[model samples]
Target: MSVLIETTAGNITLDLFVESQPLPCFNFLKLCKLNYYFFTPFHTIDKDFSVHCGNPNYPNPPNIISSSIIEDTQFQDQSLSPYLLAPKSTIKPTLGTFSFVKSIHENQQVFDSRFIITLSDSFDDSLENQVIPFGQIIEGFTVLETINNTPIESIELKRPLRDIRITYIHILHDPFPDPNNFHPYPLEPSEFQLSTMRFPELSKTTKDINSDNNNEYNALTLELVGDLPHYSIKPSPETLFVAKLNPITTSESLEIVFGRFGNVKNVNIILEPKTKKSLCYGFVEYNEQHEAESAYRKLSKGCVIDGRKLHIDFSQSVR
Candidate 1:
């Protein structure tokens, strides 16, 4: 079976190994037919490494074509069925090779919804038993490279500067006749909820800011404290410290405000852990240092956010 992924970066065609990896290939094909990949962002882009996607929680939910895919069967049983053949004993993950991401539970590893495509020649012996390489990209290597080279806001998390979203997935071919026969149990509620997650629309001001702020920021912060011979690292200049947020301000609002400066890598709102209430402060990271500086200067000059003047500065914490 084969599928064509139309992403903001470009189109990539993947050939599935249905004979060798029936369960994963079948599930992937089914998801494609149901338009499960629409608008899903490629959350991780590690240059010279790999680009990761299929995350249901990064920006928003998958565009589910049918609730049946979510209600039909449990992913764990289908993925780990004894009837299914084991993955190849060894995998040489070259560029364009596709594989599933695994989640660790105690000593056991379970399949996660996320998947990755290698961007370089590399292999992981430990992943041979855990991750299943069900497909290989047959086209659009350049698109993958473009995604890998996209500016990033966080090197540690490998988040893209701007969301490279999957526009849609078109199933070109599928040989499976009785894919439903492989079902085991009903999908868990949490899994279904995750597949249907949604987020509010970004504000116009935020959109305008992201469009205008295009310069890349790459400055590193070095701190030298008195009596200390070694210099300590501070947060990247691309990261902004935000304070005096309205108590009722939401993470979405914070994102819209700071996101104007540049592509927001991440936004963290300090909260009362137990109550999950906003503590009226947060941090926002941009892809470039100039973006953060612009936000700091503009917002510090006293921008009213939800009726409160926001305090912005460079964060002291290291990235």
Candidate 2:
């Protein structure tokens, strides 16, 4: 069985292990069918670990009458196999492995509404019995990367400052039939439950480029993605690739020059390692998209920095 989760960032498709792990897989699929995951925020995002989420709408499982639901006879007494709970010792989950958040309710193991997606290559040994692996993200990994790189409020909370929610869950294939009383929402929820719809941008009327807090947010995002310390392929709308810089031009000078357009997050001037001299081309990342667009338009028109007329374009590679 497979399901497509459409989120604010993008779409993600998961291929579930329905045959081996039917109960939890059935629970997840049933939730999707009933639109129970609608507008559920990705409440926790541990950059080096995983992103967690579930039905924030309810604290406990819904009070459904036993007679209203149908049960698969084969899976009624079937418990999750030992292998599902205990992953291979040598094999660590490497990005996009989906699992249930195991918890103890009334002294029994329960896989409730919550789930988590692996974000890194290394797995912590302590979480071996804490989560049950039942599926893997089969598509939209770029979307997963986008969610993984999202900046949180702080190291302690791990909640995204802005909401990254599941807008819709589109179930592609399911072998089990729905219960008789199962009735799902006909349309997507209209209520917007986010603190902020999006990060603040450089507005058209704002005279001060540094007035907003976009720079801080951008900095946090860059730090989470390892862009500040090391170079990573993060080709985005706000990044610009500049070429033909004067050998004398420094990253600091580039920042000062570009700070006129908007909030300059970072300026990376590529250099020869042996000599530590400028290669005469680098990248300048802005805090917002329009700022980059403005910079691209104004600077692309024969702008000079240090003695060279800089050639500017949107960066396609990592610094």
Question: Could you tell me every candidate's TM-score relative to the true structure?
Answer: 0.50, 0.52
Model 2 lDDT, residue 314, Cα: 74
Quantify all predictions' global Cα lDDT against the true fold. 0.61, 0.65
For candidate 1, lDDT tens digit of each residue in 103-169? 5545665454568888887656655665668788866676787787888877787777555666555
- Per candidate, the number of residue pairs that clash is 2, 1
**What shift in Å separates residue 127 of candidate 1 from its native position after superposition?**
4.2
lDDT of 1 at 61: 38
What clash count does candidate 2 reach?
A: 1
TM-score, candidate number 2: 0.52
Candidate 1 achieves a global lDDT of 0.61
In candidate 2, what are the lDDT values of residues 188-284, reduced to their tens digit?
A: 3332332123333323423343537544544443333332332233447888877667888889998988899999988887665456766556789
Off by over 4 Å in 1: 59-83, 86-89, 105-108, 124-130, 178-204, 207-319
